[model samples]
Target: MERPSLKSWAEAAPRLVAVAAGRDTADLVIRQGIWVNVQSRELLPGHDIAIAEGRIAYVGPDASHCIGDKTKVIEAEGRYMLPGLCDGHMHVESGMLTPAEFARAVIPHGTTSMFTDPHEIANVLGLEGVRLMHDEALLQPVNIFTQMPSCAPSAPGLETTGFEITPEDVSQAMQWPGIIGLGEMMNFPGVIGADPKMLAEIAATQNAGKTVGGHYASPDLGPAFHAYAAGGPADDHEGTQEADAIARVRQGMRAMLRLGSAWYDVESQITAVTEKGLDPRNFIICTDDCHSGTLVNEGHMNRAYRHAVACGCDPLVALQMMTINTAAHFGLERELGSIAPGRRADIILSSDFHALSVETVIARGQVVAENGTITVDCPHLDWPDHARSTVHLGKTLGAADFEIPAPAGANGVRVRVIGVVENQAPTRALSADLPVVEGLIEAEGAVCQIALVERHRATGAVTNAFVEGFGYEGRMAMASTVAHDSHHMIVVGTSRADMALAANRLGEVGGGVVFFADGVEQALVELPIAGLMSDDKAETVAAKAEALGAAMEAAGCKLNNAYMQHSLLALVVIPELRISDKGLVDVTKFETTELVEKVLQ
Candidate 1:
């Protein structure tokens, strides 16, 4: 089931030429439509598109010459015919579903192309995991390009992942069928410091003439930012502010504005194009980390595109950012992002540009979706039992495993707490004074206990710390194996008993997310595949995720998409504060720091 390659196109050139000239019939024809020409940034009315062999043969004012008795004709009826939307950057694992299920969820929303980074799998199973994901991606009906994971531990000396990706791995992955380039280089500090290993990974991707992704999470626009830009990353999607976006594009990197399940970064960064009037060509739209609920209930790339338009960007400008700009950024301008000749026939028919109501989707010269319903099957891989049984906790844990000892003879201790910011990724490093009971420190009012349990090695090692901003009360704990960058277990709770129970439950169910209150199971979403994704349908996973959110609310924790924040508590690459298997990391300093700053007098 391999699609047409360059050689196939050369072999079929004469047939396509005959079809365009009306000597032979086209396989499909779209007539009476307003064709959106993304290359020229204009819309041409009453255009006819002739398709043959899954590629566009002709696009003009009429296709009567190419029509035959057996040809399929789609009457666009004056609707706008746009190129299928493209997601410039995303991760399939973040949706809590496999690549097949993720494709099934987004096909109805008009996303025909996805540039995905499977670094989460790299952290778990290394190169083999990446290959599995890549093989599955190539089987889908629409396009799903894989990027070789560039950083596994994310930040060296600060965290420990189950597996690490080396420079040789990048070189080998470049030869993969679906590999687009190296994934996001999350180790910005390593690149700025001229780490030889990091540079070698970048060089491998560059040598293959592929794009290098970026992840500069810090807000500083100082010398480090310039050094990272010089290190060879071509685009970045981690900008959370107007300045961050401007800095990236100014440094010759494409600025990716994302609107994910929890990260509301588009409104702040879209100002670079909408208000400040920066070149829109250097900007693109993406959903960095969207869960199944958001993909099912809301939209995919369509959501980000509409958000940009609502933020005052021109409708055509927003569309270009999501379509042509994205394709051009990946060096795929000729293969996608337009309805002209010599491009893949991936088109969407919509009645309105403002609302972006996708009415019909044609991917690779075939009708794949119509009126918000999928018409084609998204193929799935037969994942082995070992892939589904990755959660390994050597021994069951008790309440004592989560306890933190206080300084001797101290009544209270001031501890550095990771503060969760609503609708953002970076956490604020704050300090809180908590009371000491007996010889252990106890969580006071708003502060709660957070622990990083090492589930990969099954050694039962736990690193404990404190955190705020979820506003959890009562005896409740939330545990997840979907911790970012490193797929370890992160448990945050007010009670140590509940924490241990929730963590042990994930190990029992293979791996997934669980919420516990008063030692009672409130909700669970089992992601048995590599402890990161589910094999179920997207709608089924979305429903379970919704229930998980409700359970978090019922436990007195109220933050927007709080589960997203919960998963990133252990991400040591992001700025400010984070926890890892090694210890608490001060990400800005790129080193581990003490949990307690000072002791009480």
Candidate 2:
């Protein structure tokens, strides 16, 4: 399908003037709605909106004079005419669905705009993959802007990607129509250290006059954070605390508090606005990584808005965070993100501010979704064979591949474990001592085996380590190619045999997520697109994901959205400890370290 084109303000200005002056009929008109002017932060009741050429032409107390017999008008019935919600920063592949499918799932939730980072696919298929995502995103009826992935490996030396993204790639992607800006710059160390290549990538984006996304994962509000702020990143979404949010906004960076499937950073950081009385304009709300279940069962940006209201934030402030604030952060204030004249006619009809029951969603002057159902078709791209065939594990594996060898004649070993914190991106660098049996350290109780398999190059290398916090019982293992930063295979299991089986099964079917327990395959979600995203419908993938959740619960693992937690084990950028293709990464230190702390004789 050709990219959906809407007239720019320059092209529609003549008609807009005619329509507003009551000399011409609007393409669409909405009557008697509470106009939510996000720019002025005011909710004016009883107004009409006139749209022409897919752009808002008039919004006032009445647009009756602008209506013709050909015009399509809807009675808002005193609903709040909110500017459509815009997600400032998100990964479309995180939902395990392609861009088209992801849009199909979120349109009903009043999400009319998205700024997606397709770095997950870039890790697997390079620039071509990013182009593929960019192309499909433009085809959607709703706005889905693609940020040129700035980090493929995410952390340059910490891990290796299937394909590395270069400065040339960044410069070239900047010219693409859908390429809004560079994706999150996860290499904070490189930025502060003034790594030339990292600086060059930022330079390319800056030279192109686009927003440079940020990802400062550290909690240090010291000079390091200040240096990173000065390094040209315009916004950051890795903030987890009130201080982190406060520090970022004070430094002229938009503090994006995200509420994803497993991340609950919004509530903690929202207090900066609610309590300290900081300006809400510099604070944004986004979903950094929302899975399909969250989009389908709960909501999208609307979910984040509701979560903020529940966090004691004023409803209008929350709406601003979800709408105008996000658009302004991306430098798209004049184009979209509001119901004002000269903007894209993307608006939502909601009856209540507190409950925000989205009754209708309009995108580009078209009714895209209504009453929890999509009314428009989100176009799909024909994915090539190379895109689907990404999983390339070198050889078959066995239980030996996951074994951590004990030190010479040691009875017990102190291991640096990747501690899983429930519902947060950062992990704790905890240590645990376990007994060794026959020259191998075995997983005991809460401590399970975590292995990073080299699926990118088919190098047949497996880095073994231990992780705690997921209290799993019996023989079970889960394998996923949706590992963050690097699209490698991460398997966590009690039984090594089950881990091996799950990994092999995913490798057999291209790529996806799978669960195994008691020597039987329990659940699987096939993501054939770059092993990171599925071409199937969002509902289909969500259903499969639900079964996988059931399997996780059956194995006695009871962390909220444990699958999301499982996928981030290989995310080396977020501190404090994470497993990678090279070795155990101490993110706080920004170097590879030993898995074992010491050996007990």
Best by TM-score: 2
Per-candidate local distance difference test: 0.91, 0.93
Candidate with top lDDT is 2
lDDT of 2 at 115: 96
What is the per-residue lDDT of model 2 for residues 1-601, given as tens digits with 9 covering 90 to 100? 3468798899999999999999999999999999988888899999999999999999999999999999999999898999999999999999999999999999999999999999999999999999999999999999999999988778887899989999999999999998899999999999999989889999999999999999999988999999999999999999989999999999999999999999999999999999999999999999989999989999998889889999999999999998899888888899998888899999999998788889899999999999999999989999999898999999999988988889889999989998999999989999998999999998897899999999988998999999999899999999999999897999999999999999999999999999999989999999989999988889989999999999999999999999999999999899999999999999989899998899987
Q: Name the regions of candidate 2 deviating beyond 4 angstroms.
A: none
Per-residue lDDT of candidate 1, residues 1-601 (tens digit) = 3433322467667878999988999999999999888888888899999999888999999999999998999999999999999998999999999999999999999999999999998898889889889988888889899999999989877787889999999999999878888899999999999999999999999999999999998898999899999999999999999999999999999999888999999899988888899999999999999999999999998888888888888888888998899889889998888888878889999999789899999999989999999998888888878888777788999999999999888889999999999999999999999988998999989999999999888888999999999999899999999999898999999999999999999999989999999999999999998999998999999999999999999888889999999999988888899999989999889889999898996
Give candidate 1's whole-model lDDT: 0.91
Structural similarity to truth (TM-score) of each candidate: 0.98, 0.99
Q: Lowest-scoring 10 consecutive residues by lDDT in candidate 1? A: 1-10
TM-score of candidate 1 relative to the true fold: 0.98
